[model samples]
Target: MDNRTNLDDYLAELGISEADESVTPPPMPDASDSAPVQEAADTDARGTLERFLRGLIARIDPELSVTVREVDDALEAEISGENAARLAGRDGRTLGAIEVIAYTVLSKQEGRGDTRVRVDIGGFRKRQADTLSKLAERLAIGVAKSGEPHELQPMPAAERRVIHIALKEHPDVMSESVGEGASRRLVIKPRHG
Candidate 1:
């Protein structure tokens, strides 16, 4: 009926039980204790998220496992095991959905909304980044030699970012995103002096 109930139902379907909501409030602390309190909150949030992800993945496939770690001020959850590839889905749509849901749930918590979450299944994101990086390199070379711009197929913003980062410091080429929304694409162009 209510949003909380709906969220609980959704999480239940995903195999994550509703967390106990009966937490006792902590006493006010002095300024000197603020840093430790914040650090403890961060650790608690990370542990909660890790447990949630592990439960969700286990529901999908009992054999799957998730490892969560902090990377660049964000939480990265890597799912592995026999069903990892299948869970990633075609073009990683499933993985993307999982990441979105995970973040949404995490943000709903009182103090965890600012935490950033990244979910990668079976190294899918890593492999895709490597491929995109290599493609950017090859295209930059061609564009430099031909003095023409090469446009890439439409892709999600994240993928486009990969291409941009790949060519960020290229001596003879530059990358840009053109178009809008779902039709947006990356273009590699020669950088003339």
Candidate 2:
């Protein structure tokens, strides 16, 4: 007598017969395919992210377009369209969300590591950075003139980073972050003589 465990026999042992609809067997692996499918999937993270962002933009508005490129270890995506500002939202929260979603999806792919994706719409991020830099310089100058420390409204880590960088080489003022979590902000103080 032959002793073999077939699909029906195994399912029968587990009290699930061949007629059970919920106990279907999984699809068999493709024997002819020898490539590293998992690695292949992650090898084109930038391209995948570009496609994903474009699809997302399509859902928001079909007229929107996104251009993505690899900048060192990060992906920079620039979006242009009539509804681009809608993606930017107030203080770029919407754009940030899109980046987070893209990164999440990319990182979840097999073999991904330390993903960085930046999303910008119509150069809004550049304009915001420039405005923040100018504000940081103005605050630093004011602090130096009055010999008093000035505190800026709480901002996201990225904005605070811009402030610190903008004032890092200032002649008469220094910048630092204070507080915790969402309450964290930038403080400009007169440099000690």
Candidate 3:
């Protein structure tokens, strides 16, 4: 018999799954069908991403023993392992803020383009996404069970999008993004209205 496990367990562990397999994958993309599109997007996204990142570092912790590095197919800038936690902020809030700012700035600088880019400062956003995904799922379940709406703290539109997408699968709950501009937040509520 093939090894089998619950789908939720699979998603929790691997962040994704195959239709017929029990194997768990790491929390990165599969890079199969959309490789070319992804590759092209990243190629187009990198130059602006790097310029934004370098400028951010120069302004923030200029003497923190850290530096920004660029790659061809990267939509986000990475720093050497030497400096992660400090730049990452508490659970990546600071990093997320930086990324949002860069995305907004670069997208505007390039003439109001909705460029699809992800900014990862030292992998902080990566880890935070995984962690927040699970947290959002659980919190959604709780909100559904209690039939009470939950208002999350303010976060960027991107992060609110992250949580909104993560909890989309559960039919018992729904999410709405409210507030305006930088102070926006996601509110979870029972689906029945």
Instruction: State the TM-score for model 2.
Output: 0.73
lDDT of 3 by residue, 141-180 (tens): 8997899999999987767878888878778888999889
Q: How many residue pairs clash in each candidate?
A: 0, 0, 0
The candidates, ranked best first by TM-score, are: 1, 2, 3
Worst 10 residues of 3 by lDDT: 1-10
Better of 2 and 3 by lDDT: 2
| TM-score of every candidate relative to the true structure | 0.78, 0.73, 0.55
Better of 1 and 2 by lDDT: 1
Residue pairs with backbone overlap in model 1: none
* Candidate 3 clashes between residue pairs 3 or more apart in a chain or in different chains: none
In the range 110-138, model 2's lDDT, one tens digit per residue, is: 23558678889978899999999989877
Q: Each prediction's Cα RMSD? A: 6.1, 11.4, 17.5
lDDT digits (tens) for residues 13-124 of candidate 1: 6686764334222222233544577676666556656766765765567698888887777889999997688899988999998898888767775356678899999999
Instruction: Give each model's whole-structure lDDT.
Output: 0.78, 0.73, 0.61
Q: Candidates 1 and 2: which is better by TM-score?
A: 1
- In model 2, the Cα lDDT at residue 48 comes to 60
On the 0 to 100 scale, the lDDT of residue 141 in model 1 is 90
